[model samples]
Target chain A: MTRVGDVLARCRAEGRAALIGYLPVGYPDVPGSIEAMTAMVEAGVDIVEVGVPYSDPLMDGPVIQYAVETALAGGTRVDDVFTATAAVRDAGAPALVMTYWNLVMRRGVETFASDLAAGGGSGLITPDLIPDEAGDWIASSESHGLDRVFLVAPSSTSERLTRATSACRGFVYAASTMGVTGTRTSVGSAAEGLVARTRAVTDVPVCVGLGVSNGEQAADVARFADGVIVGSALVRCLTEAPTRADGIRALTDLTRELAEGVRARRSTPGGAPGGASGMVASA
Target chain B: MTTPGRFGDFGGRYVPEALIPALEQLDEVRRKAMIDPEFVGELERLHRTYTGRPSILTEVPRFAEHAGGARVILKREDLNHTGSHKINNVLGQALLTKRMGKKRIIAETGAGQHGVAAATAAALLGLDCVVYMGKVDTERQALNVARMRLLGAEVVAVENGSQTLKDAVNEALRDWVANVDDTHYVLGTVTGPHPFPEMVRDFHRVIGIEARAQVLDLVGRLPDVVLACVGGGSNAMGIFHRFLDDTGVRLVGLEAGGAGVTTGRHAARFSAGERGVLHGAFTYVMQDVDGQTVESHSVSAGLDYPSVGPEHSYLLDIGRAEYRPITDVDAMEAFRLLCRTEGIIPAIESAHALAGAIDVGRELGPEAVLLVNLSGRGDKDVHTAAQWFGLLDDAALQSAGAIASADATGVSSLTDGVQV
Candidate 1:
């Protein structure tokens, strides 16, 4: 019943950053996916983003794209993404739906948000939709209990950055660079700078995505970010690990690993945590 | 038919395990399609009715005069619908996609020729299409974006690294990964995971098949040499594929040397680059130590690429064909020579082949007949050609721009050997 920001605030109060992991709804198989989502929650994921498969995902890197293909071929569709997320809702596990605008647009913004909320999705991340251009979807999403988030990259101008921050609802997505999501050992310091600039624009949570490829990188990113979203690495593990179960286990463990990483350094010299309760950005 | 994956180590499939099954399935698809009566009949129908098959083979006597009197024949693929031999492969692949039960198609294109052709095929097939072009190329070829849109393809301008043809390929592959269940990637050139190079070449071999028979019929004997320009080398493959078994035909593949072998701004895969994996299969690639593909530059945008088709590598090693270079200056001269001497303006990419033939023709003497594929009309190069010839700055060409039939792709479409 709590909002995505509420869970993030609870994590901040506990001196830990939210760790969001994304997994295709029917990856490996339906049962395996359910088990994976459950495993991710048990392993320490504060939030999960269940993807709705689309015929085209132009923004994804090779790893996540392949996961989408595998998942779709295994029969994962938009309804399944919500169906799979129902368990997360029933168990009180915090989750959101990560997908392309094409899939979201097809489902209709209001229907998508309400369906996501009904299935226990606490937030919505439309990586392709810039808020400045979002007229109807932004308004409808807020009315339906879904927090509409936007991604701003290092190349985003300060003007656009301000507009993006104002338009965002749940958390501001701070991309490390103009590139697609992929594995990297560490987040660039530019990411830290961008996070700070976004923080100045709004009190809403900012999730630094892209290049937060591993637990250590996530820990490093959480030093300045409210949350960290790991996409390609989790998808890569889901597809490449020796066994389907091992892959799921590895992905689920990433959330806990990243969570404990930032939690371990809460008392360090740097600003340890930012509060969860705040006015979500209102445009 | 017993050919192994290795092109004596030059054309082997060096992909990861995850891609092998897909590659093999594609190769099988190719094998079955070749022998399937219905498939063959459908292809023939498209070739004859749709693409205007058996495209003309012309004899260039004036250009041939410089050649020790060696007879020269030009296979006029420029005369094909939508222009360029790129149409042949894209149509074949689009047809195959429909056969495979896929409803959506995706492709990567540079210089707009392949993109236009792919979009045209998608439109005709009534399939949804997405074209990923590099942002740089999209800017340079804005006309192509409009053309693709007219064909009902959503043109996505990829703002990724370098924003050239290679980046477009990477983007298309990523799209394929995400939508593999319902989408078929119509790879433009003879690159990417196996079967594509082989498949595209097979689709285009009709050029060589037509040229060979025409040469033997008209000249009463096989020509001493055959020449075509090489970028991804589909044009070269189109004219050379059938000649692979012909030992008497001297096969010459001309690559862009840019300025010279040492100048480094050229698309000479065999002459300058090493074998590497690009798109999908292993081929001659222009790359640095870290295995990153290097940027290749040439006066011809179509030839401005870093790799050659894997099949070309196989042909090179098996001693069936030879790849050499034609500098930018030399290609332009050949472009002018064909225009002035024969009154036919040829695509700058095909002009590389003309430059190569001019070099070897003089040595071969008057009796030799060399088949050069006039792959496309040179209208697309009018602006660049004007700059190269200093037409805008030079008073002579500027005055004759309208009289020369070398204005842009449109004017060239009205000239000799042009099928407008």
Candidate 2:
């Protein structure tokens, strides 16, 4: 099994934060998407989370909602998402998927998990599917050799902490705020608290998403968690640049910027020495 | 009795921590502004001049003649601007949004009429509008898309699960969560957490308030029955409000039976849905026993939701009004019958009430005066109706749409007033 500690060690040794970018399943056209993913890999991407658009994306803001609509209108299906990931796999990049439980539930978790595993997907991140209500999914996904990435918010209870750790395989996603996914100018103090609380529950790696915007925010967040997941900022990357190449270039540039920021702090002698950088240096 | 504004044990504000301060702020300012002389005056002026309120009290005698000779009167909201009672609520909510000094409006729409109305109001007030609709509904109601864009609104099609009204409500709730500080969420129907149903009903109450007086003036008596369609129940609630306390006015609420309520194919929440909290408060919800919401359907896209407002639930429980269902076939039949009899095309959603009135009239017989609310005109249903009845090829439906107008006798006919 690919353990959380190992992924964390490898990420630290590389001196890079995991760059997770989400693209709508059939957005900018599906075949065009394969080319884009390959481009993103060549541009130095770490991980990718493909969003399967649903008709009721209860958590998305307008920007992502528009993107999902555009993609679904193009007839993006779960199979299409799997097919779309072929480019990521052929390009040899690890990929995760972010979608609502309803889609997976409707498709039957066992079938979806197997299909996703067969399609070369790595992990799953569902913000609303609670660990308590997700037993069937956890068993099915784990049975199919998939990582069930559970989310823990700042408002999560101790019971939630226990449930989240036991149900998850990959790093537990720690939401930094009380609300839905959105942008904020700075990292909250509660971010550190949530990490500390989750650290007490189990030995699994913890990652934060939903508020980090730039290299500085990622750099700030990298100080505490295993890795940082950036979405809206990356989606913004797609809209900012005129072409897919420019979009890939933007993500690659930010990935490198954040990687360097994490590396500097990791390499400093005895400054904070628990990560892979210290192990490599000591060896 | 029962504090006037409540709906069953389920209609109070059960909001999150973040929404409290803003809601309380709205409460303090809303009551004062709604009751102010200037505000009321402007609202009335717009209601009269722009919307053509004091909307007509119509009599359907041929239909009435069939109904054991009962006198059937219609409250003609279908003649209002934009062709539905949705205009009545949107205008009021829009004015309140403006007075709050907000610059942007966000709403969730299903069939797109409410989105059109909200967009129209935002355009009139020069406010930026963002209407989130389920992607499926967007495809289904494309003409409404053109209408909204012409009004200068941004239409964000949501591709969430089921791609229906409930999902649109969820997306709109998510938007309100992120932008509660600077934006106003103009909820179309009256089913969200709190104050939405109450606030929307207050705006629509003008319909019932006006009709009560008009019916008395015209007929010299109160109606034996007052009826309207119930989707989110805003129109029904609005039309039912003044009659809530009237002992003699028998208010009836009609819900869409879709294929049939028993077959689980309808959007008649009050008939099949149970009491549960959805959106923000407890109300009649189309949820499974496990509590997840189920998808609802109706021939009328506007009424196609799995839940209804809390206040309507309260009304049903307290027996203040009666809730019944009208199937798609029934509503369509009423749609064709009304057009041939009265020269008016009603919205499919509103046609549900027209269906109820037809039944109620037959049962009541001669000497019974019933008021059926024509909640909206039916231009949108022309395409759907044409397809259903083979009018697409029959060449009978698309005849310049010039049906014989029912004269002052409350009945007109091309074929001796015998539709059957």
Candidate topping DockQ: 2
Q: What's each prediction's clash count?
A: 11, 12
**CA shift of A212, model 2, Å:** 4.5
Per residue, candidate 2 scores C-alpha lDDT tens digits across B1-420 of 112235657565433333444555566566786889988898898888888887998788766655567788888888887777888877777788778888889988877789888998888878899888777676555556556766778877765667777887887777775677678888898776556778888888998899899989989988899988988888888888898788877888999899998999998888888776566556787765434467888888888888888888887888888889899999999888888887878888888888888898888878788888888778766656776777755455433222211221122222332231
Model 1: how far residue B108 lies from native, Å: 1.5
lDDT of each: 0.74, 0.72
Query: For this target, which candidate reaches the highest lDDT against the unseen true structure?
Result: 1
For all candidates, state DockQ relative to the true structure: 0.03, 0.11
TM-score leader: 2
My TM-score estimates for the predictions, one after another, are 0.60, 0.64
lDDT tens digits by residue: candidate 1, A197-230: 7777777788888777766787787777788888
Error of 1 at B124 (Å): 0.9
